[model samples]
Target: MSDILLSAAATAACLPYPALADELAASLTDSAVTVPPRLVQPLPGGASLFVMPANDATVAMTKLITFTPANAGTGRPTIQGDVVVFDIATGTRRLVLDGPTVTAHRTAAVSLLAAQRLAPNTRGPLLVLGAGVQGRAHVEAFVAGLGVREVWICSRSPASAEALAAHVRTLGAQARVVDNAAAALPDCPLVVTATPASGVVLDARPREDAFIAAVGAFTPSMVELGPAMCRDLMACGTVVVDTRDAEHEAGDLLQAGVDITALPSLAEIVRESRPRPAGPVLFKSCGWGGWDLAAARLAMLRVCAEA
Candidate 1:
């Protein structure tokens, strides 16, 4: 069979947030799925290339992408690449999807899955830090999957933030661009941090029952939430990682010296049927191959349904 190449928009069309979340939820406990550790290699000028591979009984995929920190605010995507999917049984190439699109949407879908279980309250308005690709994807996910109606955006770049606000408005949600994310924290129970920061962006304390999805700062050297905030979450709230790998890649938690071993993972929550926490919930996502696999599987199912 001929391999199908899907553009970013096309790839996105296949992996709707609600459907993608269901796929992720199922894959989390799927014993047949195998996700190997992603490899990150340093590129010239401080950029890095990532290779993430995963497979299940029917489909296998590898996501190859480049992350350039310097590309922030440059009108160019910081993440760019493609995901190649193959038939597990025949080892035949089946599909090629836009990598960055898969990354953003799948990452947000994982957060949505976690929120379905962890968020104390799903009501809006949702506060999102950063105005890049992941920021846009999260806004779409929360609005679509959780029915969040209002979105408050905060970013270091005002222009980018407004652009994100415009995008939010297009999605039939009320959008507000705030200069201070910390100032907006108390009133906003649902929060997402998607920035590329070497230091803290959200430091202020939030409400007692807030739900925060921290997706930025994958490396130990990069941090978005303040160390103190991380500590407070650990002491008074519940911290959930997308995977056990966050113990190594989650900068905010690592910088604060939070013991990740004590925190539950998304997979565990799904498998054990864990309930929502009484206090605030912090979901730390460091990316996982299994998530990409979920996206690919969803897309393939869509492809077959359409055919």
Candidate 2:
């Protein structure tokens, strides 16, 4: 057994996101790999701690994440944690990787994959909700993966949203802070909502051909898309989840009284069983454990390759 560690920056430095996207696109199957629903523990002040574990044949990965929503108000990120990867056969710990970073990258990769299948031709004016870890990561992901022309940023904190927009401009992508995100939706074809708001952050869906990748609201009680959008998706089979486990964890769909089994999984879409449904396709993720394991292993390989 061998052990190694990498900072989030270092792991990100060597991450070939396009390649990782390809890897993840093929990683999920009916039985070969799976991510179980995370075990959750509520914390004081409405914060939450999650212990997630996932495994395949060769290795297993576990991540510990704590969400302190209040931290974002104080100039710190809301999510903090790390990921551990080990040999499954021997059960020996092999690598420890930054947790939130892994989550960010994997979450974005999943979104990108879903978008590739759902709205392969969409371009320009991507609307991103909440300028936090997931929001920032999704901006980079969309810019890299889709060549989006402009990104509209919206957040409860104007300064944080503006700060992210400024950083996004530095990446050669056009970005702006939108005071009214709902009003900005029609202009954008792809939207990524990465917030923990219990109420709807994005009031309306893009009316045209589009994709919405929602990552927040893991618990059954926290929702992001509100009632009408979920209801509309539920009726049309337009909603897609990163995995079947999302049925148990995705708050947006669960709260909207969605029929979990009715929605198709990402693997099913990727494998060609289901065509991308018509209009306002949604990819809701409650955070898949398989994604954590896959990302950690990729980081481990990148670490070794750079040595």
Candidate 3:
């Protein structure tokens, strides 16, 4: 069969968050998913290409992506890629979905799933770091899945941040760009860090009951939360991650000398029905490959429905 193509916009339009969440939750609990570590090939010019493949009972999918941080200066996306879906039963390529959109939706949806079970709401506005794809996507996902009345964006590029802020305003939220990310943290009940920074991004003392979703630092060499902040936040509430692998892959957790095995995975949280703590809770994601499988399967289903 010919491969079906799903663009980023179409993929986002057809994304099934609830179904994807349920699928991921089940896979985590049952260990039915196979998510191999991604193969990374970095170019000499500081660009990186990542190839991640995942499989399950229904489908096998692989995503090829590139990260070119310098592309932003040229008015290009820093992240670009596509996901190829294969029929596990027939061993045939079936569909191709836009990579960034799938990644953005799946990543944010995973965090949203955690937020639903953990810190459901906060008293203040939502603060997001970075103005790129993941940053804007997280904002939209949170506002869609939850009730976000206000949003504050912090970015290295004022133009990008303002652009994202304008988009958020169109989404019916009070959105604005803030100069100080650290300063904005204390007042925000929900904070998302989606930058590519190699060092700490959130270093402030947040609200007693705040929720943090760290989505940027996916490698051991990169960190989003400072050691002190990580320690303080972990001490306040349960720290949940997307997968067990994050314990080793997440620099924020590792640099903080956090015992990853002790922290609950999102699956464990869903399986055990862990009660939300009264204090703060942090969700650190290192980007699970299994989630790609779930997302691709969802896209394939949508393609079939349309056909």
Best by the TM-score measure: 1
Give the alpha carbon lDDT tens digit for every residue of 164-225 in model 1: 99999999999999998888988899999998866799887889879999998788788998
Model 1 regions lying over 4 Å from their true place: 1-3
Candidate scoring better on TM-score of 1 and 2: 1
List candidate 2 segments past 4 Å from native.
Answer: 1-3, 89-91
Worst 10 residues of 3 by lDDT: 1-10
Model 3 per-residue lDDT tens digits across residues 259-293: 88888888778888878767888999988778888
Find the number of clashing residue pairs for candidate 1. 0
lDDT scores for all predictions?
Answer: 0.92, 0.79, 0.82
Among these predictions, the greatest lDDT belongs to 1
RMSD of each candidate?
1.2, 2.3, 2.1
What shift in Å separates residue 199 of candidate 2 from its native position after superposition? 2.0
Clashes of each: 0, 1, 0
User: Judged by TM-score relative to the true structure, which candidate is superior, 1 or 3?
Assistant: 1
What lDDT does model 2 reach? 0.79
